[model samples]
Target: MKTHIVFGESGGSSLRLALKDHQTNENIVVVVDDLMWGPIGNILLETVQEERIKWWEQVLNEEDKSDSIAYLRNTYKRLSDWTIALTGNESFLFWVGDSPTEYTGLMFLLANIPKSIPVSIIMVFPAYYKRYGRFKPLSAGEIIPEKSSILLKMQNPFLHGLEKDT
Candidate 1:
């Protein structure tokens, strides 16, 4: 199975949703850090429950069993194999009140990724304005550049989802 690691500020969730099904049965590991002084989302953990109420409502409405929850847990467990076993270390990570440059955990985790499997990295930021800004997606052959490669940037669907609010 190929491995894809996307890390950046402002568009982590958008990255996940875009890459999740890139390859069938591919394992996806998404880690979000606090974006206030650091990376992306700035909501407080204490208030995240209330803030995420709408998200939870959608989740509950979309998924109908504990197994759905279990699937995520199992997928995450597999991520450790690459980080711990391969890298031989771990650290306490705090996303809340941190800056994107401060964590740098993704760099460590990514260093351990086996080269045998295909891999790619994406860095996103808000371009233009919040309402319409997007992290342009890289086209096939562009993500992993080689001879005769053509790189193209595509629109992010998560940003498209935000169109509803606009």
Candidate 2:
């Protein structure tokens, strides 16, 4: 089975709809917390996890879910477990956009998962944006859900000694 890992919830949701349209049984894992903004050290450790939760609650200006939801608080732990539980038969297709959050999430996934597991990435970007003779970066949310099927054909190799499952 191939699991699709995405950074934000919107990106994950869009990719899920795309996968449904493409008629695939791929599972989606949405990393809600923005790793780019938070202090990431040892997420598996309970003490660090508490510090991050407190950071989110007190530092970030958002409604606190640490005290309200049990499952939500252990987001990193769940991701870590998911990564550890991946079998040799399972593959990963990371839907990465041009965002720091995606980059961090991808790094986390790469670090945790075994090197034997095959990997692929869908790099989303704006088609028409031109900035200083360079294409502007885009997030997965910017990708058209209808074009996901076609985009699958354009998946790029996440090369770092990683290759797609043959």
Candidate 3:
């Protein structure tokens, strides 16, 4: 069966809600990480883990440090396992938004995803240009699978560079 994986910030709850609302036939996997504004190093396994631990330590309170660390480790483990399982599967979609964190996640996926697996990326624009001339930035929680059709389609970053060809 095809699987639809949604990568975003906010601990995956919003994506899961959105996917549940959309009622898709495909199995869904949500990878949530708020990497938008943080210190990120090379995407190597060790570097990524060290950077994440450092970042979490700085952001989380001393009392919550242990719990937060455990959560981060578990989340990363789940994401890694899911990525591995999805390889060679013909059907998969990566739903990402236009943000530093989301973009980083996209790059990571592109680097690791199997070349044989055809992955479609739906890039959600940060803001909507209203007809009345107001630009409204969308909240990360606002994106839902039901509204995915309106999102921009970009060439797979693995095959094509991150630049948008005009």
Candidate number achieving the greatest lDDT relative to the actual structure: 2
- TM-score of model 3 vs. true structure: 0.62
Arranged by TM-score with the best first, the candidates are: 2, 3, 1
Residue-level lDDT tens digits of model 1 in 1-166: 4333433322334434444434234333444321222222222222332343334335554544355434433433444444444332222111111224423544444333333323332222221122233433332111222211111132222222233224
lDDT of 3 by residue, 1-166 (tens): 5555556454145555555665644666665556555775443364686687788889889888988788777767776666556546455566665566667776765665555665666544432232112433233345443344334233244323332122
Candidate 2 has an lDDT of: 0.67
When 1 and 3 are scored with TM-score, the better candidate is 3
C-alpha TM-score for every candidate: 0.30, 0.73, 0.62
The whole-model lDDT of each prediction reads 0.32, 0.67, 0.56
After superposition, the stretches of candidate 3 with alpha carbons farther than 4 Å from their true spots are: 9-11, 35-51, 58-60, 126-140, 144-166
The 10-residue segment of model 1 with minimum total lDDT is 143-152
RMSD of each: 14.0, 4.8, 5.0
| Model 2 vs truth, CA RMSD | 4.8
Clashing residue pairs in candidate 1, if any? 34-95, 35-40, 37-99, 38-98, 38-99, 38-100, 39-100
- List residue ranges in candidate 2 displaced over 4 A: 42-50, 61-71, 74-81, 126-137, 157-166
Off by over 4 Å in 1: 6-25, 32-78, 81-103, 126-166
